[model samples]
Target: MIACPRTLFWIVLLVAACFLAGTTSGAASVPAPADGPGLTVVMDNNYPPFSFRDANGELVGISVDLWRLWEQQTGENVQITGLEWDDAIRRMEAGEFDVIDTVFYSEERGEIYDFTAPYTDVDAVIFFDADLPGISGLDSLDGFVVGANRGDSTVKELQEKGITVRKYPSYEAVVSAAKAGEIVVFILDKPGGVYYLHREGIQDRFHYSAPVIRGQLHRAVKKGDAALVTKIDEGFASIPKAAYDDLDRKWYGTPVAEPADLRLITFFAIVAVLIILLLVVLNHTLKQSVAMKTEELKQELDHRRRADEALNRATQKLGFLNAITFNDLQNAVFSLSGFLELEKSLPADEKTLAYRQKQAEILHQITAMLRFAKNYEDLGMKPPVWQNVSQTFLIAISHLDMAGLRRTITLDNLEIYADPLLERVFLTLAKNVLLHGKTATEISLSCKRTQEGLVLVFEDNGAGIPLAMKEKIFERRFEGKKGLGLFLAREILSITGITLTESGTEGQGARFVMLVPEGAYRFTDNS
Candidate 1:
């Protein structure tokens, strides 16, 4: 049978009220127990779906609902205390709370608290600014600045795996920072990300990458609270599957994952034992068979060794090819820039200058394509080298046919650490506008430093993308036949820890905003 936690809380409150009323009548002048042993649950009030503040600023959510059920079924008072996420975690670790709600279990965390059977499945997702390209998976996030909620297991897991994690105080802060372009990627639980996107009204702008980090969400209690853990597990088991499903639907708009059945484990164990017995019986009759199997294993090991060698060689070759391609593109852009400069000096003839300008633009396109390809490949394998932001901008502009297009580029020239390869990111975007921005006669580029990091703007006077296409454009190969110019641009920018997103869809033309994190420009000693 399922016990509704919310209903139980109300029932308890009602009973307490009646008890106080009857006691006031001087029936028995006795005091209630002060501090008897009971369950203490710590929960964060700001986490929606899991837990959050209601209109009255009271803590409420699925966890709150479940705890009420525990109280009602056991007829015991489980004191629920609200605290901030960080404070709650610390208190739980210190054994101040007998139970902590909505914890994701990990091997490291298991050392601190005993975990209940998993009740939910969570997958980690990457959140970026609306204009940024969608990340395909963890590989796409290599070398990108990713934000995570501080004290979260997600942060711990990422850091432990050698992925850089920027810690924020709250999920709201993480989203705000990501939207403001302080971080290129924000890693979060899928459900949490969805809830946050809807709450922040940015659902149309941001998306989750297809690949996810899968994990189990389980309840946790103090390490020594074996009895409480067992009781909670029992409570969970007693709940009807339908009731659990309904609660999941209410919170996440999806059915909850069914608990894993132990039948498969039992079956596998039985199969393994039979196989072992068969092997033992055969061993006595076939001594020669063991030698033949050993030879086969040796051959298999040799083949694997060769495959590993081949893979290493392939990786090295790819890296070399990328480096060579980048250098070639750089030289080609320099040559084009020089030619354009010479065209301006020679003649004022309109037709001749126009031809030269067109040639320069074409060259610029080729240069951008090569650079974009190189950067895209590099992001998956190497960390970007930190360089001056101004330098990156200049490299990007070098690929622009500025003399022919007659566009002005302005900047505050603020110095910050940035990836040199990010030059391709801007070049590709500028080229995209020149090629497709039909209504645009002018393009403007500029940058500004904010309290957190930097914001780069690329605006064009061309007719903006249709309202419907604005969000879809960042999708990988979204236009089907269209090449991956914009997608590649987004990928490269992400590598340098910048998120590219579209802004002001209702305005005259398209405006792309790139939020660059401070980490993107940090200078290392070698640099």
Candidate 2:
């Protein structure tokens, strides 16, 4: 009996060793010659429309279609692996995958990966709470805590400006934080944010700011994958616009019809048929009716063209005016900076110098507001560049002369992509604190990222905005005869696709919060 058991164990060990050898041989054999250059592409299976898993657990979307075309054209044997976005990115960075599909190229990304020519364009926007004031541009987010996705381009941009940025790992975390009042603002790519908001049934709870930051979506390849990138570029160039349009219609449910050919042959065919009928009286009547109809159509078209031109001119004029005003404000601030420097050199009369320095600081705040306004005007222009939130904040704070404010501003490493107009929103709120919260000695500003978007918080221990004024604050020309700073702040923020609102009450001081919608930030060649 002992001998029989020992023999059985040896037999089982022999089978296991054979199986291991076969597995090793399979892995070492390499892909067949006909399989072409074996390459593995990584992508996020959770991102819909671009790349995602279907109901049957199949990886599919526009990126998949494009990848198939690439394989066909280049004879590259490609395998796809679906993973989480962060995991895919990390793996690609680690050189574990040959490529990552559907990423937006930015300055920060340029350091990490080689990007192909863009295949799609998108925007980053700001989304605010339902009770928030309407935001028309970037200027409306002043003093609001903004939330953004961690490791996103928008976080860098927000940090560039003086605005506070909070970072979160995922979109869901951002939404939860916003709902919990942990952050006031969120920013994200437009479609992704909208999809998430709708999916979470929070569409009615938040609003997006306008004048979106445009970003171009592209495929990312491992650095030094020049051959692959060139092949992709060539393939993209070869694909007909019609084919792309058709694919778009298929996925997005939008019909795209080709224009009918209007060749001479077609016109002559109709003419010949009419003449062959030989109905002279009918032809004359028809010609008269057609002429009248054409004339009317031409008249309407001319009127519409004129109207469009007039509207464009008016918009241009308004933009120019805003720019000029912004410049004036900047000049005033610059002058104040110089005066403050001069005051340092003058004989020190402690109290008088202090008062003068305070005055200069106040002027500095006004300049910040002006800079924000200028940014708003610039963002309104066609082909606006991505505004760096971090840079803007640095500029705003650099002018503040911290020695004078008696308040500390704490900011986390958060970035956001928004139009420069958002700076004005921050400036406006800060200016309000200086003007109205005179008794308040301490003000706090913070920013962090949330999964849903970016959230910003601004709080001051001063006389807060009255309840009566809260509703009216965002209205244009409100705030009792003052320049439409708050109103324009709201309007400017709206233009960037974000919303701003007041939270907390008078006795509790004031808290301003802003949310950036998903898809609000994007990468674009036009910058």
lDDT winner among the candidates? 1
Could you say which candidate leads in TM-score? 1
> Every model's Cα RMSD, please?
20.4, 19.9
Give the Cα error of residue 28 in candidate 1, in Å: 34
| Residue-by-residue lDDT tens digits, candidate 2, 1-527 | 00111222322332232233333323422232355458788876655455665545666666666666556555677788877677777888898888787677887788877888777766788987644554555566556667776656677777777777777766556776666545546887765566556656667768888735787778788777788888768866776566566544334542122224444556789999888777776668866997889999996775455445434654675676677676866776677776677687778778657759677666766755655455445434442234545445534443232223444445543444444556666677777777777667666777656897777777788888788778677664412446467766665555545677888588767788877666454323322
Error of 2 at 166 (Å): 3.1
- Candidate 1, 419-440: lDDT as tens digits: 3446676677777777777667
Error of 1 at 406 (Å): 26
Instruction: Tell me the spans in candidate 2 whose CA falls farther than 4 Å from its real position.
Output: 1-37, 53-58, 134-139, 176-182, 240-243, 255-527
Pick out the ten consecutive residues of candidate 2 with the lowest summed lDDT.
1-10
Stretch of 10 with least lDDT, candidate 1:
24-33
On a 0 to 100 scale, what is the lDDT of residue 131 in model 2?
40
Give the Cα error of residue 290 in candidate 2, in Å.
53
Q: Score every model by TM-score.
A: 0.45, 0.41
